[model samples]
Target: MLCIEDLLTLELFKTLPRNRLDWICDRSQILNLSTDEILVSEGDPARGFFIMLSGRMGLTRRSDGMEMPIGQHEAPSFFGEIPILTGDPNPVTVRALTDCHLYQLSSEDFLTLLHECRNFEQVIFKTVAKRSRGLESFIRNREKMAALGTLAAGLAHELNNPAAALVRALRDITPALLELQRMNLVYGQHQVDAEHTAQWIKARDEGYETITHKRIDPMKLSDREDELLDWLEDYGVEDAWKLAGPLAEGGTAIATLEELTARWQDDQTKMGTMGLRWLALSFEVMSMISSGLRGAERIAELVQSMKSYSHLDQGARQLVDIHEGLEDTLRLFSYKIKNGVEIRRSYSPDIPKIWAYGSELNQVWTNLIDNAIDAMNEKGILEIVTTPYSDRIEVQITDSGSGIPQEIKSRIFEPFFTTKAVGKGSGLGLEVVRRIVEIRHQGSITVDSQPGKTQFTICLPIG
Candidate 1:
């Protein structure tokens, strides 16, 4: 049923000699496939070269038991050549999308033609090159999307705690302000003596300063709170425990409270009520202000870290502090490391900044540090050490995780080579690191691994 006229339509056969075309047609068998029929399953052994004669076929790749359509083969197109040439299992499943007619050439016959026909070999190799580039381009973009997704997830998690703290601080400060205003009106009405009122204001200001500038020891604070509670209760103050916490946090001494209460000793009701309430409320306002300030600072710090990691407001290539970049990445990934990972940094203060692609260089650090976290499973020590080498700055990132296997170490930097499970890795992370460090920055990266320690060392020129 097949004719040389059908072969003429294919660019591959059109360029081949008449005798060779006849030879290929004779050696190949025709296969008719109905819609939805599978021609070859992924991981199946290579059977032959398939040249599509009519209808369309689709190719789907399986990743983690999920099938994803990657490409298609229409009439006059050919496949199975890559697997045949490499002698590997098929990388994707091929199925007919419509009723299809295909010419299947046995592997032996295909190789014989490859060896004997110069034009045929050239055309096949060209197709291989073009197809390889297309696949790589598609996969590289997917790898970037995957990496961005991971970093976005980590960033969201890292931002949550501080953002929540900021919200809570803002919410609590409002009610405290209203309570302070009510206390101000009451103080004017009570009209205590000027001298004693000045003393109370002085004491309140001092307590505010202590809350703002001093750090309290937890154990000491606990002891002081108990003492204050006992004294307040003995003096007939109701809810004595309510005033203990802020007073203790403000580092208020028992003697100071006693002296402040001396004026109101005869008026026990006032001393136990207004005097105690005023002092506690003053300390509470100061504490809320401090908490709010700290929450805002933390939010700002995270935002600044993200900006630095991205090299915002800067050109692509610039003089970069490698240590700063590493720190920024660590800050961005703190959510992942803070719980169990201990990070130790050793830096050579004299090492100079390097001229390089700033953000891309940061990407190298991100990938290396992220990989280290994964290797340790978030529970080991990670060390970052920088020192001056011969006219270069050397950064060594070492992790206390199970080391890379000797056999696979050499291939770890190869694109599409991964130890991670399918769907978890696009396998381009280390390859991108390699390209950025070596090709883009003209730097060198090397790995040293053993049973419990694995180190990735990068040396960049001081330019």
Candidate 2:
């Protein structure tokens, strides 16, 4: 049983004249909702209009298998008008926050009131517009945050390997250096002849040069190490096996070790053999230091790429080299692609810089490249082609994965539409790409696909 008095209590109904209010009360149905009850579900057919009478209701939209509250409705508030006006399904699920009373107007009656009352129509439509704008704003921000989270996770994973190498290098180098120093001090106390010392120094320097400058064949080095191991054991050098790897890596032949240890063999003490051991260990330490430096340099390079990709220290809009941005994004995503994906680049060497939002352009590249990697299931060839057009530059990213199906291609850029599994996508990736390319950079993006290949082309004006 619906009453005129209850209808008048709602702000939207208050604006309607007495006759219209009476008409609405007669056509409307009274609905009572218990706590946690569902009012309308997302994607459900637009049934009618609702005006809350008492208690509260919460609106939520599904993303990544979770219900995310996007808006709410309380007593005297109205909803369901948006879907009715647009003739579309409900965009959000509405559930009761508390036991509630509401008035539901049929689509026919809701339309009649919309047409017949000027003030009532104005208020309802305005509220619809305001709510729509607010929802859009909220979702847009959420999209950016989600994208940032994805990028951040990818960046952390990519940085970890090189960073760990750098740490291990630093940790191991100190002890090796100290051990080498102790060996040097022991040798220095002995009154060794200058000529013998010179011979030892020359041999040590040559081994270091060979190890640092020349790459040894692993098979040949293994044979050489075996020969040296047997020779050192026969000559009575303690733990001869321990010196074999370093001496082999340092290009120390059995002849070289035999000649270097000749003087110590006659001595009752094994100082000469000890010196040879120290020299091989020293060469090994040098190799470690070299590798550590390389790891540190790699870490520095990745950090710089991350900074450039984000344009953290740069202005919002600037003249940017498109290839630079693309490369930076590739570097950040390298961890994901490194296992099996092969990247091919074809850049027109002279492509000009373009004025744009540098970071946004990077985001565009990130999304497209990331999507391509996923499309390939992380094990196909990805090609980036850049061509200079008249007053613009065209960049294409192509992946050797099964192309997007024709039926869904047209709707791919629609917000919250995705082919990815639940919990793996928010469905805003391509929408963000479209907004950045078309709205932020004044560019055009187009895609072409087939069974084996899909290419996304972005054209940006040079001016």
Candidate 3:
């Protein structure tokens, strides 16, 4: 049974006159809920306005495949107004935490009261605004954290291969250098002729040049390996195949090996094939050093790209090269893009750097590129084009994917609006993009879409 005393417990009900209070008491139905019982679920239709009289309830929203607690409601609290007012589905689930009693007012009756009482309507609208801001704030923070997690994971993946190569280079080079020192000691003991030693030195230097420069044609490398292998076997070297690859990669000729090893053939000591072993080992070391250097350079490149993309060292607003920002974003997303996406870039060579919020602009690029990749399901052509004008610059990102539907195109930039499945999107991505471009940078954005192509164009002031 409903009573005037129960309605008065809430301050909001106190705003109404006696007759209106009586009206609410007559129209509101008593609803009892057991602990853990759901009153309304996220995405459920607007049921009505609810006035909590006793006990507590929990509010949770689905995000990233998990139910996240956004807030709680205690006794003498009121809710269920946001959805009713907005005429939208409930954005969160409400579940009783303890046995509870509440009054559910039909939408029609709530609206009638809202229109009839100015004070009641004022209070309700204020509460609605506060709650909306709170929910938006929580979800926006979650969105930023989620985006950071994704980029961190991608960075780890991209760093792995080169880091491993670097470790292997450091690990293996030490043993090979020690072995080469021992070989040199043995060769020095022989006190071979100066002319003979000069020939070996000349051959080793030439091989180093060839390996470092990558002078050998890959197509011809296999044939060279075969020739070296056959010559080493004929000369009685054990495991001749092991030495062939290094020798061929160094662009070693059969004649050079013959000339260098001609004097050592008759010597029964390790000196017999020492010349051949020395040359192969030397070439292998050179190859390792080259590979290690390349890996280090790649690591440095990725690190620099990330640093530039973040604009950590720069001020909030700086002269930003739009192409650099785009390139950095593409580099970060390379793991996703390389799998199946083809990127086509066209930038006006004369486009000048513009004063803007550099990092925020990068975020705009990140969200758009990320959405473009997903829209293509990781397999399609992503085209980026930049055109410079006297006063402003226009950047376009186009993807070959199923286009945005015509009906929802206008609402695409609205906050909390999304076509992505639940838990797959926060629905704030485009909203953030819009804010950064239009509000923060005083830029404009527009989208054009069709069956196979969707392009988002952003125009920003150069000054």
Candidate 4:
């Protein structure tokens, strides 16, 4: 049974007059719970206000398909007010951590008392604000972590192909060089004729040019390989097919091979086909070096893009080039954007750098671009245009995809308001974007949407 002493144990109840305290005692119902028992679950309808007389309760919220502990409630505490006041479902689940006794007041009775006592209402609203801020803070951190995880995964995916190519090139180049060195030593033992050697060197240099410059037409390469194969076989070279493709890729003419090999044909040593073998191997080695260099360059490019996107070397606030930031983001998101999404850019080269929070401003871009990609279902044309003025710059990101409904357009920026399925969104992405733009940077962002086209326009002062 509820008593006056139990009511007085909480400072909040002490704010009420004696008659109101007696009224609470009469109206509140006694409830007992064992350890691990649930008091209320997340998303449950607002039942009433709860006053914990004894024991502790844990508060957890669901995020990304997992239950995360947000807070706890101890004995001599009160809760269940936020949902009741807002007339919304509970945002967290409260479960008893130990055997407990609690008093629950019906929603109507709690509201009646709330209106009757100004001091109590004041205290309740203040607590509500503090708790709301705490929850928001926790959620915002989780959102940042989730975003970071996504970028890291994309970076890894983008790095894989080039890294593998580099490894294969390094692995294959060593043996080819050793074989070429053996061929050169054997050829040095023969009678040295300056004119004949010059012919072979000239042929080698021309082939090197063809391979490095990719001068051979890919369509003609197969037919050329067949012609080389027929000549190599007639010239009695073993595994003639192996050398044919590289020889053809090097733009080797069958007539040139005949002229170069004419003297070696009469010789009865490995030198008979050694000159032809040397030319093909030389071309293959050059191709390998070119491929390896390109792969290394690609790796460097991706690393630099990620570093610039993060603004890791810069201070919190700095002069930022809008186009550079946008380009860096697109590079990082290339894995997502390349799957049938076409990007159209109309950047104003004259737009001046703006003094702003560099990393936070990038976050604004991240959220908006990420959302645009999702809205398009990863297959659409995304258009970005920048307009520069003397005092301000405007960026418009437009996507060809399903647009926001007219009725929900106004509430899209509200915190905790989202159209994404549960676990797919925290509902604070655009809200955070709004805060960074309007509140932090003193800029403004607006969205215009209709079926098949949605555009978000952001205006920021250049200072």
For each of the candidates, the C-alpha root-mean-square deviation to the true structure, in angstroms, is 2.8, 2.8, 1.7, 2.3
The C-alpha lDDT values of all candidates are 0.84, 0.84, 0.90, 0.89
Model 4 accuracy (lDDT, Cα): 0.89
Q: Which of the numbered candidates is closest to the native, going by highest lDDT?
A: 3
| Segments of candidate 1 deviating more than 4 angstroms | 1-4, 26-48, 55-71, 86-109, 266-272
Give one digit per residue, the lDDT tens place, for model 1 in 1-463.
4678888888888778888888887877989999999999877789899888899999876553577788899998888888888765666689999999988899999999899988889999999888767766666666666656666787888777767777887888788789878877887887778988888788888888888987788898899999989988987788989998888887788788888888678783474367678889889878877877887888788788888888999998888988889998898888889899999999999888888888898889988999999999999999999999768999999999999999999989986677875556656789889999899988899999997899999989886
428 Cα displacement, candidate 4 (Å): 1.1
lDDT of 2 by residue, 1-463 (tens): 6777877776777777788777777887889999999988877889788878799999887765778898889887777888888775677889999999988988878888888889988998889889987876776777667667777888788767767777886888898888888988888899788998888888888888887788579999999889888988888878888888888888887777778787678887779778878887888877777677777788788888988988888889888989999999898888889999999999999899889999889889988998899899999999999999788899999999999999999988986666765445656788888988899878899999997799999999888
201-234: candidate 3 lDDT, tens digit per residue: 8988999999888578877999999988999999
Better of 2 and 4 by TM-score: 4
Of models 1 and 3, which has the larger TM-score? 3
lDDT of 2 at 345: 95
Q: Once superposed on the true structure, which residue ranges of model 3 sit more than 4 Å away at CA?
A: 215-217
Clashing pairs in 2: none
For candidate 2, report its TM-score: 0.89
Worst 10 residues of 1 by lDDT: 268-277
